[model samples]
Target: MWFNWLTALTKGVLLMAIQIVTDSTVQLTAEELATLPITVVPLIVRIGNQEYFNDGQDITNTEILTHLINDTELPKTSQPSIGQFLEVFDRLGQNGDSVLCLSLTHFLSGTVNAARQAADMSATDVTVIDSLSIDRGLAFQVITAAKLAKNGAPLEAIIAAVDLHRSHTKIYVFLNTLENLIKGGRLSKAAGGIASLLNIKVMGEVVDGELQVAAKGRGKKFLNKQIDAVIDDIKAVSPAKVGLTHVDNLTTVSEISQRIKAALPETLVTIHEAGPVISTYTGIGALAIEYYTD
Candidate 1:
């Protein structure tokens, strides 16, 4: 009877746990965890969703797991450095639960690869997942996985959940400057030039685990209008559960967030700034919006 009551109570709660480290954060559901037989979670550095982090204090920013990448000059490692991920693994392993690290992408950063190396080096059992998308496109997956693991789901089942729900998410980004992409080597100079020539405001959507350009418009002034059009398109397909993120763009953040809340009050809306890592590529004053459909 006690066990049955406990199960019911756990099911009733969100069963979520979130942790913050220097420049990123990790959120998981304590109810369903992948690393089994070991009940303690420690020494783990939750990777930031490779999205933009905002720097302004207009909103309460505490407990969001933001890291400082503001003007921190570091070599672009096409992948997260092995040393970086290893530190977290070693710490998490201290508690006897094998380290389970999350990676933003195998697409942009070798962050997951780095985690593999770290796990090998430390000989700590590790599970690394390539969310295939950045920001909350990946974040929601992490949250879902955490919940499953806490619910006593095996690692493989948790990973399957991550992959399954990831496919349902949509991510969109509109950047004011392409230089950040070029500077971080995420985009080619030619593509940047072409986008600039037409004063292109990009509209990207996550499809099949990749961020595909949905449309390109000619000016910053047309951005809001363009986004609205995209929203209309999404609505035609289905209603969406969305998340909002920004990098030094308060006005756009507030404007779009307000507009979205008005249009879809039933959707869960969250706004966060790009932490230092993602900011290095998207630059400040950029915005990313993400959502999901059934």
Candidate 2:
């Protein structure tokens, strides 16, 4: 059925079909993956001596959170191996299709580099894009590329559209604790300890592919005010979609979702649990909001 749709759309105009590929960091459910014309390569997550794939099926964000809470060692995530990328590329291009692979930000992960390296070695025609963002922010670009590809858009057109979506997207994360940051070496132990002693909650935003501290304060009220400010910022733009992702913080994410929905009722809104790869850095009680504007 999907092949028929592709054939009908590209019948006389295109030489070959375009295939979409992305890493597991993108915020998409198993059902969404099943229905969408896209392929995902899973990231590897290791907790202590155990290794799990961030494929949503083999491992879940909840299970990762449990280990994060109970285990002493911080979880570590690795990008899919070059061989993994080659496998997907070779399989997808078996029918002479062109593959477009999107990966999480280079600053956060080495996935894009690996994809590019694999593309060089594989016989298939493959293009790799560094998404420059993660979670739903990355999904905005990947899903847009998939939709355009499915509709028979040319490779250049799909890349252009994806870049446009990327420019229009913003991601903000609220960190509940600094323990992960310290353990992951994103923040110094001294700084994290000082912040923890003060009970500070940090707000960070993804900018130019790097996470930067945007704001900080103590308590829920400060976070609420910051969220309201973000809503106000959203009102200033023509928002297309808003996503809320949390690491074991449904209550807070739900409230944030409600606030966004109330402000932009017509815009598409979705909520997801952050995957293991993301949870490894964000830790428990973190909430991330991804905003895509038209």
Candidate 3:
């Protein structure tokens, strides 16, 4: 189905896409990036990175591929600026279709506001939604939007579903360090300053539209306890769709998945490497589990 879509997207045709900047799926090569119904925004997207876009085998550029293979990783920037997002909205407008953008948590980043600004000026119709969550946290919302657009669902309906689900979703996380949050300015001075004295570890979940701490762990072993809390919370909600994501730590993801399976075998759980943008705050050991419980 993905391959078919690529074939259909001929001649810089306008396309409907779900743009997300999370720890996982963000660094995919342009070819890898474009394969999804998604547009992966890096922590930083450079001016010339578009040259390597691999729309398909026929469209793949050897020079670009060569650069990609030789370079350690793609260069990224802060969440795309409002002007940058406008460019994408404008281009898609040429194809006579709107874009539905699913963004990471608003509390976590300013990316949503930037996207809204761009959409306001876009010639095409654009709906920017705040996932209000992170990790694969936003995956289902993105997937549904993409699927709806692919199946010719009206832009308005697609946007509505995205909005509805964004409100329904919940994200739970276990942070290995408050250092990442501190650096990202997420942790208050009281929280970060006493990180050492408190020997801080953060275990939190989003409920009623707020990031609230459920517990604090002092070290690695204690993180398991936090995971236990997460599982218990999930059990109470029993979401139909679920995912586990880690910034740079696949190890933690594996460990959590096994636990989730044991605790909630009926739920579907997907594991993903965190994309660069999300990692900026979540840190290497940052792990998040998200699902829809209602």
Candidate 4:
């Protein structure tokens, strides 16, 4: 469906063309990213002494998981520098095109600030927006803006549409292990140790630009109940769109996708492998869902 849309866009004339820019944290598939009118600025990823750019390049979720399983130092991620964003903004705007920059939550990373600074330096009209969510949640807003832009919608209209989706969209994360959070210093060592001792599964939601616990329990059954409750909430939002992402956890993703599909047959679902920035926090075997509830 997306391919066909792109084909039509290529064949038709566009009166108002807008360029969409987003960082690598948005969990969009390579094919999807290639097909859209979007430019992705790679985030900086550091593992041990080696450095990688998430510019749709050599790094992948599988490689990140392998490092995690080997007990290598927890991967560290950083936002793109202002210089990097300035370069991308200049390239994408060279054709006198308007650019809309969608960035991951400012609370989680300084990528948004970099984009904002670059926008101020650019000669073209650029609007930078904080997605307030990462991974597929960020993907949701980027995709919506791309579609609106493809239809020749003005930049302001597309920005308004993305902002609306950002408000309604939510990301739910199910952590299969507490070690990553502990290693990354996101969770206190003491708290992580307690959760591990009890065999607890942590569930959290990205709210108000931060990840916070919504519910958690002792076993997978409780996780299933939590998934069901999330599905119920999505159902209440008529004609909704949903996205699912995982860090090398296909079994859990398949099960959750089946449940969500069975419940909301008409809802659109996009499944993606979590990218480097997101995988750094989610770790191996983490499953997440992103959807709109309005």
TM-score of each: 0.70, 0.91, 0.71, 0.87
lDDT (Cα) of model 1: 0.56
> Cα RMSD (Å) per model?
7.9, 3.6, 8.6, 4.8
Residue-level error in angstroms, candidate 2, position 167: 0.9
- Model 1: per-residue Cα lDDT at residue 243: 67
Tell me, by lDDT, which candidate is best.
2
- lDDT leaderboard ranking: 2, 4, 3, 1
Better of 1 and 2 by lDDT: 2
Model 4, span 1-294: residue lDDT tens: 323345545788545478899999887766777778988899988988889997657687778778777855788988899999999888887877889999988877889999999999988778999888888888889988987776767766777788888888888898876767666665666655566556588888889777776776888898878887877777777437788888888887787778778877887787888887778887777888788766
Q: Report the number of backbone clashes for model 1.
A: 25
- Which residue pairs of candidate 4 clash? none
- lDDT of candidate 1 over 81-142, digit per residue (tens): 57766676676565555544556656565656766777788755676656777776766776
Backbone clashes under 3 angstroms, per model = 25, 0, 8, 0
* Tens-digit lDDT string for candidate 2 (132-216): 9889999999888988787777788888888998898999988877768766765566545566557588888989888777888
Candidate 3 CA-lDDT value = 0.62
Better of 2 and 3 by lDDT: 2
Q: Quantify how close model 1 is to the true structure by its C-alpha RMSD in Å.
A: 7.9
Query: What lDDT is reached at residue 149 by model 3?
Result: 67
- Per-residue lDDT over 1-294 for candidate 3, one digit per residue giving the tens place of the 0 to 100 score: 324444546556555543332222222334334655565443342324442122223222233334333555433335556777787777766756667777766676677888888889888777777777655656767766666666655566676777777777777877766665665566566644565356578787766545666677677778877777767877777787778877656887887778778878898787765544455455556788887755
Q: Give the best candidate by TM-score.
A: 2
